[model samples]
Target: MSTVGFVMLCHTALDRAAQVARHWAEQDCPVVIHLDRRVDKASSEKLRSDLKDCGNIRFSKRHRCEWGTWSLVAASQTASEVMLAEFPDVRHIYLASGSCLPLRPVDELREYLKARPRTDFIESVTTQDVDWTVGGLNAERFQLRFPFSWKRNRLLFDRYVELQRRVGFTRKIPENLVPHLGSQWWCLTRQTLSAILQDPARKIHDAYFKRVWIPDESYYQTIARLYSTRIESRSLTLSKFDFQGKPHVFYDDHLHLLRRSDCFVARKAWPQADRLYETFLGPNHRESQMAEPAPGKIDRVFAKALERRTRGRAGLYMHSRFPRLDLENGKTCARYSVFQGFNDLFEDFEPWLSRRLGTRVHGSLFDPVRARFAGDADIYAGCLPATAALRDDNPEMFLTSLIWNTRGERQVFQFSPRDNQRICWFLSTDSNAQISVITGAWAVPLYLSNRDFSDIRKEAALMQKREVEFVNRLRNIGTRADVRVWSLAEFIEEPMENLQSILDAMDGPSAPRLTEAPRMANLDGFGQFLQNLKNQGMKPFVMGDFPATNVEMHQPTGGPRPYLVKK
Candidate 1:
C-alpha cells in the first residue's frame, strides 16, 4: 500500500531530528530532510550518519535559509523534489519541521490518510481575508521588492521599506497569479506536488515570489490551491502563533492539549522539552492509553487529611495562625493552594486543582500584593512568593512550598516556627531544566540582554548554585519541624500514585471512595484579573512585591528608604 512521505525542514538539534526521523521510519514512511546550510560540516555529517540506520531517510541539497527570505522556499522545494523522486509509491507528502511531533499513533494516521486519499490538508487564505493582516504585516508583502536579505540590518531594512512606501514604487502581480498567504506547513498529494513542479508557469511564479517577503508561506499554498481541486483549508499540524506571528514553544504542560487536539502533528517544540516528546513518543507514553483516575478519589484523600489536622478548628487554615474555631458558626472547610516560582504557574494547574479539591481556589491570577484574607470559614488559595523578611507570628500556620527550579535562581525563604507544619515540593533536575530559559527570562530579564555564549554559560552555573543553596536552606529547616518533601515530577508523571503518596505524607486514611465531581473554578474572574495586570503593566515575578515604604516617615537607621514600585 502507498504511504505518506515526510519532508522535514531542520536547522539545529540533530538528536531530536534523528528521533523524529526514527519515529516516522518505524511507521514505514519515507523521510526527506533539508538541513540548514549554516550548520557546521561535522555536525551535518554526524546527523546523516545517525540516520543511516533509518532505511528510508534521505538528505536534500543544503540551503542557507534566512528569515523572511526566498531561501526558505528554495529549501522546501528541494525537499519536496527529493521526496517525489525517491519515494515513487508515496501517495501524499506532509511538510513539517524537525520540531514537529506526531500527536496520533502512526497506525491511526495511516488509516485516516487511506480513508481520504484525495483530500489535501493545507491552510490557505486569499489576500483579501481579514486574518491575513492579523499579524500586522501590511500589503507591502506582495507589493514591494525584498531582493536583498535584511536579516542582519533590521534598522536599515525598516528605513528602506518606509522609503519605498513613500516613493510609491510597487510591483504588480503577474497576469494570472492571485496572491494568497497561510501557514508554511501543509500536506499535499503526490499528484498535486508533481503538477506544481511541472507547471509551465512555475518559473514566472518563482521569479515574482523571489522578491516577495516570506515567500515560503505563500508560494506552496498558492500553487497548491491552483493545482489541487480537493483541498481542506486546514493544516493537520497544531500550532499557536503569538502576536508577532511566531509559533509558541511547546513544553511538558502542553501535553494534555496535544493529546486532546486530535491533530496528527504538533510543531515548534524545542529540543530542551524532551520530556514533552518522551511523554508522547517515548517508551512510557503507552500510559496515555489508560483513563485518567477520578478526581473525586484525590479530593476525598485531601478532605480526610484536612479533617485530621483541623479537628479543633472550624476550617483548615493554611499559612495562617491563631485558631478562631469558636468565632466560626460551626462549619468546617478544606483549604488547598499551590505556591511556586513566578513562571512555573501552569494555567491548567489552578483550575485542575480547584475541580479536584471541590473549591474555587484563588489561583495565580489573584492579586497577592494586598494579602487580603477572607472570613473564618472561607478558603483562600493562590500562588504567592514566600519572602524571608515577612514572618507570620501565628503558631498554628501551615505552609506548603511547591519548589520547582524553572529558573536556577534563589527563592527567598524563612524557617517556619516550631509549631507550624511545612511541606516542600521539589521537581527532578531534568524537569527543572525543561523550562529554565522560559522562567529565567521572566524572573531575571536583566541577565538576558546582550550576553554572549560564554557569559550565558557562566550565568547558568551561577543560577544552578543559587538553586542548590535555596534547596539546602529548605532542608535545614526540615530538621526543626514537621517538614515533608514531595517530588513534583513524580506527581505529574503518575498522578494517581503521587496523589496517594501526598495523602500518605499528610497522614490521611487509605483508599477513600470516589465522590461527585467538584465544581469548576471562577475562570472568568481569573481572566479579568489577568487583563487587569496587563492594563497595569505588571506580571508575576519570583521576587514578589517591592518593599512598601512610607514617604512621610523618617528612618532612624538610614537617610531615606528607596521608593521602588514593582514593575
Candidate 2:
C-alpha cells in the first residue's frame, strides 16, 4: 500500500481526469475522486466506467462546487473523509483539481513525501503577509459576510459589500483561528488532515467558514497550522496567477516551460494540449532525476507575460490590443525629427538634410493635400499611404506605425501651420520626438508669393495664431520632447550656429559640425511684409522685428579665419 493518496475535485473533462487517476493507481497510490454534482448523468456514468478497472480508485460523495463559495470547501471535506476511511495505509492526502496534470512521476512524488515524513506542504500565510489578493478585501474578506456569489450575482455582491462598509458590519471569527489565505490545492500529512476533519469544534469552524468568501483557500490553509508538526508554507503544485486573479493555463507549446519548473504537479492544463498529456502521462514519464521542486525557475517568464498583457509591447498598436491613449507604454518606438517651419526657410531642405545626415528626410508628412513621403512616393514604409483621408482618420496610429515599421533608420519629417495640426499635442508629449522650430517662418512663402496684400494678411494672421498655440504646447510643463524654438529673427542672425545646434542634437556630440549649409530662402522683403500685415490690421509679431533693408539678413558675417599650416 502506497503512503501517498490523491483527492481530486473534478467538474469537467471527465476523460482526462480518469486518465490521471489511472496513472496514480497504477503506481500503487490510492485515488479518491469527487465529481461535482452539476455534471450531467451521462458524463458522470462514463467517468466511472472508464476508471472502473482500477481497484484502488473510489468515488466519494458528490457536492455542487461553485467558485468563491462554501460548496467547494464542502466537496473537499466529503472527498477527504472518504479517502481516510477507505485507505488505512495512506499517510498523506494531496488535493488537486481535475485540470491539474502530474508533471513528475508518481513514484518520485511518493519518495519525495517519504523524505519529508512529518512536514506538510501547504501555503499557509497570515492575511497581513498576503499580497496576491486581487479584490480589495484582504483582511476584510475574513471580517465581512459574503452570502452573495461574486460570479453569479455581481450586483448584489458589490452592493452588499458597500452596505457592510456603510454599517460597519463584520462577522466574528471563531476562536483559535487566525485568517490565512493561499492556493486551494494543498498536500497535508494524514495526521494533520485527520485532526482537521475530526476536531471537536469542526461544526463551529464549518459554520463560521461557510459564510467566509473563498473558504477553500483559507480553511485547510489556516486549520492545518493548528495540528501539523512541521509546515512548509508553499504548495507542492505549481500554480501561477495573472495580474487579475485568474490561473495561467498551460498549452502544448508550454511543455518546455513546465519541465523547467521542476514541480511534481501543475494546475489548469488546457484540455486540448495533446503534446503535454502524451509526454507527461506516458509510461516512461520518469525521464528526469528526482530533485526538489523549484517553481521559481519559470517565474520570470510569467512576469514578462503579465507585463506584455498589461503594458503591451512598446509602440506596437493593433486592432487586437490597442491600449488607451494615456496608458500607452510608448507613443512611438524610435527617435525621429520634427521640423516646424524649417522647410519654408530653406531651399530643397528635405533632400539637403538627407544627404547631410545620410538619413531619410520627408517633406510635410501632415500636409493638408497629402502626405509628402520621401521621393514623393504614393506608398511608404509599413504600407502607409500618402492619402490625407487615411492618415487623418487616425493620425497618432499612422505616426506610430511609421516609426515602428522603420525602427532601424532615423526619420526626419517637416511640419507647418498650413499642414494638419492634429498631431501637435502628440508630438509635444512624446519623448522620442526631436523638434526644432523656427517660429513665424511660415511667412517666408507668403512674403515671396505674388498674392494681393489683403489675402496675404488674412492667411498670415491665421498661420500666426496656429503657430502660437503650438508653441505654447511645447512650452507646457508636461511636454516631454527635446524642443528648441528660435524666432525667425534670432535664427537668421546666426543661421550656421542654429543649424549646428540642431545637428548636434540629432547626431550626438562627436558628430562633425555642419561644413555645408542649405541655401537660405530670400527674405529681403519679409520684414516689410510683416509691417504690411500690421498695416492691414493684423499683428504678425510671431516673425519678430526684421529690417526692411535688401541686404542678406541670414548670411554668416564672414568666411572662416584663415589657419596657418604647421611645418
Candidate 3:
C-alpha cells in the first residue's frame, strides 16, 4: 500500500475527475473524493460507476460547496477524514481539485513526500505579509462577519460590509488562533492532519470560521501551523493567478509550460485539453530524476503574460484593447518625419527626400479630397483606405494603423495648414514624431497661385492664425515631439546648412555631407507678395522682413554667389 493518499475536491467535469482519481489509484495511492452536493444524483452515480474498477478509491459524504463560503471547508474536512479512516498506511494527504492534472509521475511524488515524511507543504503567511491579493479585505476578511456570498449576493455583501464599517463592528477572534492565508491546495502529514480534524477546539474554530470570508483559504492554513513540526510554507501543486485574482486556466498549448514547472500537479486545467490529459497522465510520463517542486521556474513567463494582458504592445490599437488617448503606451511605433512647409517651399521636395534617404515619402496624408499615399496607391499597408471620408472619420487611428503596419520602415509625409488640422495636437504630443516647420511657407503656394489678391489676403490670414496656434502647441512645456521651427526668410538664408543639420539628425553623423541642394521655389516677387498682404490690412510677420526689390531669391544653394568680375 502506498503511504501517500490523495483527497480530491470535485464539483463539475466528473469524467475528468474520474480519470485523475484513477491515475492515483493505479499507483497504489489510496484516493478519497468529495463531490459537491449540488451535483445531481444521476451525474454523481455516473462518476462512481466509472471509477468502481479502482478499489483503492472511495467516495466521501457529499456536502454543499460554494466559493468564499464555509461549505467548502466542511467538504474538505469530511473528505480528509474519510481518507485517514480508509487508508491506515497513508502518511501524507494531498488535497487537489478535479481540474488538477499530474505534471510529473506519481512515483516521483510519492518518493519525494516519503523523504520528508513529517514536513507539511502549505503556504501560511500573516495578513501583514500577504501581497498577492488583488481586491478585497485582507485582515478585515477575518475581523468582519461575511454571511453573504460575494458572487451570489454581491449587493448584500457590499452593503453588509459597509454597514459593519459604519457601525464599527468587529468580531472577536478566538484565543491562540492567528489568521493566516494561503492557497487551498496543500499536502500535510497524517499526524498534523488528524490532529487538526480531531482537535477538541475544532468546534470552536469551525464556528468562528463559518462566517469568515473565503475560509477555505485560511482554515487549514491557520490550523496546520499549530500542529506541524516542519512547514515548507509552499504548495507542491503549481497554480497561477492573474492580477484580477482569477486562476489562469491551462490549455493544450501549455503542455511544455507545465512540464517546465517541475511541480507534481497543476490545477484549473481545461477539461477539453485532450493533449494535456493524455501526455501528463500517460504511463510513459516519468521523470528521470526526482526533483523538488519549483513553480518559480516559470514565474517570469507568467509575469510577462500579465504585463501583455494589462498594457498590451506599444503603438497597437484595436477594438479589443483600445486604450484611452492619454494612457497609450506609445502613440506611434517608429521614428517618422513630418514636413509642414517643405513641399510648398521646395520643388519636388518629396521625391528629393526619398532619393536622399531611400525612404518612402508621401504627400498631404490629410488632404481634404483623398490621402496622397506613396506611389498614389488607392490603398496602402494594413489595407488602409485612401478615401478622405474614411481617413477623416478617425484620423488618429488611421495614423496609428499606418505606423504600426509599416513598423520597420521610416515614414515621411507632408502636412500643411491647408490640410485638415485635426491631427495637430496628436503630432505635437507623440514622442516618436520628428516635426520640422517652415512658418509662412504656406504663402509660397498662395504667391504662385493666380487667385485674386483679396482672396489671397483672406486665405493667408486664416492660414497664419492656424499656424500660430499649432506653433504654440509645439512650444508648450508638455509637448513631447522633437520640434524645429524656422520662418520662411530665416530658412532661405542658410538653406544648405539647415538641410545638412536635418539630414545629420535623421541619418546620424556617418552620412556624407550634402553636395547638392533641392531647387528652391521662385520667390522673385515673394517680398512684394508679403507687402501686398500687409497693404491689404493683413500682417504677414511669419515671413520675417524681406527686401522689396531683392533679386537674390533665384540663387541656388551650394553654388557661387553672383559677383561682378573686373573685365
Pick the TM-score winner: 2
What global local distance difference test value does model 3 have? 0.90
> lDDT tens string, model 3, 245-321?
99999999998899899999998899999999999999788789877778998999999999887888888987888
- Evaluate model 1: give its lDDT: 0.57
Better of 1 and 2 by TM-score: 2
The local lDDT score (0 to 100) that residue 46 gets in candidate 2 is: 94
Candidate 2, residues 1-567, lDDT tens digits: the string is 598999999999888899899989999999999999999999999999999899999999989889999999998899899899999999899999899999999888988999888989999999989999998988988899999999999999999999999999988888889888898889999999999999999999999898888999899998998899999999989999999999999999999999998899999899989999999999777755888899999999999999999999888998888899778888898899999888898888888899989988899999999999999999999899999999999898899999998989998999999989999999999999999999999999998888998888889889999999999999999999999999988887777778888999888998796767677787666677777777879988877667766535434446772221111
**Per-candidate TM vs. native?**
0.52, 0.97, 0.93
Candidate 3 stretches with Cα past 4 Å from truth are: 545-567
User: Model 1 misses residue 284 by how many Å?
Assistant: 6.5
- Write down the TM-score for model 3: 0.93
* Model 1, TM vs. native: 0.52
lDDT (C-alpha) at residue 528 in model 3: 87
The candidate 2 region of ten consecutive residues with least summed lDDT is 558-567
Would you list the C-alpha lDDT of every candidate in the order shown? 0.57, 0.90, 0.90
Name the regions of candidate 1 deviating beyond 4 angstroms.
132-135, 283-567
